[model samples]
Target: MPRVPKIIPISDLRQDASGVIKRVSASREPLFITQRGRAAAVMVSMKEYEQTQHELEILRLLARGERDIEASVGFNLEAVLADADALLAEQQ
Candidate 1:
């Protein structure tokens, strides 16, 4: 299971932004920011944020590939280029 992050209110963030920032930077886990009793935003170190974004992009690409496979829509690079060349020759 994924670990739950520590939640902080926006007010606390405003009052001691520097300290909160320091805490987040020093910790491995991300911090959750709440506003009006609802989840508003997330706070993570730059390295962690970049890593998470990269992982999400990879997941998205994997999902798209899986969908294409399930729908029987795939690629044959060599065959495609050969067909393209033949078409071009015919046109010429």
Candidate 2:
């Protein structure tokens, strides 16, 4: 079962932004901010945000690879792997 995200009113966020931010970081879950009883914005911890961005970047790379394949663009698998390994090593 999926856990429901924490929801708060904009006023509550305005009143205690730090507290709300702490809750998000501790739970590692998104906090949904509502305005006038409607959904407004969402917030997540820096850790979660970074992880999401990394995953998104991987998805973008996969999409680009697919595009390249459809366009008949040639690429060497070994060279790509070597470049990927170098990039991963740099991250480490």
Candidate 3:
């Protein structure tokens, strides 16, 4: 079974901002902030946010690669692998 997400009303967040930050960071999970029973904003730790951005960037690159392939653009496999390794090394 899937786990339920952590959620709290805006008021609760307002009352304990630091506590919320700690929980999100510790769990590496997004915190759903609600306003008047509707979802308002999501909060995440800096680490989580950075990791998410990196993953999205990889997805974007893959999508761009597909577009290039359809356009008949060419790239060397070794060059692509080397670039990917360098990019990943920078994140470490």
On residues 6-84, what C-alpha lDDT tens digit does candidate 3 reach at each position?
8899999999999889999999989999999999999999999999999999999999999999999988899999999
Clashes of each: 0, 0, 0
Name the lDDT of candidate 2.
0.94
lDDT of 2 by residue, 24-87 (tens): 9999999899999999999999999999999999999999989999999968899999999999
Give the TM-score comparing model 2 with the true structure, all chains together. Answer: 0.79
lDDT (10s digit) by residue, model 1, range 6-87? 9999999999999998999899578999999898999998888889999999999999999999999988889999999999
Output candidate 3 Cα RMSD: 6.9
Q: For candidate 3, give the lDDT of residue 8.
A: 96
lDDT of each: 0.92, 0.94, 0.95
Provide C-alpha RMSD values for all models, in order: 5.6, 5.6, 6.9
User: What TM-score does candidate 3 reach?
Assistant: 0.79
Candidate 2 colliding pairs? none
Q: Where does the lowest 10-residue lDDT sum fall in candidate 1?
A: 21-30
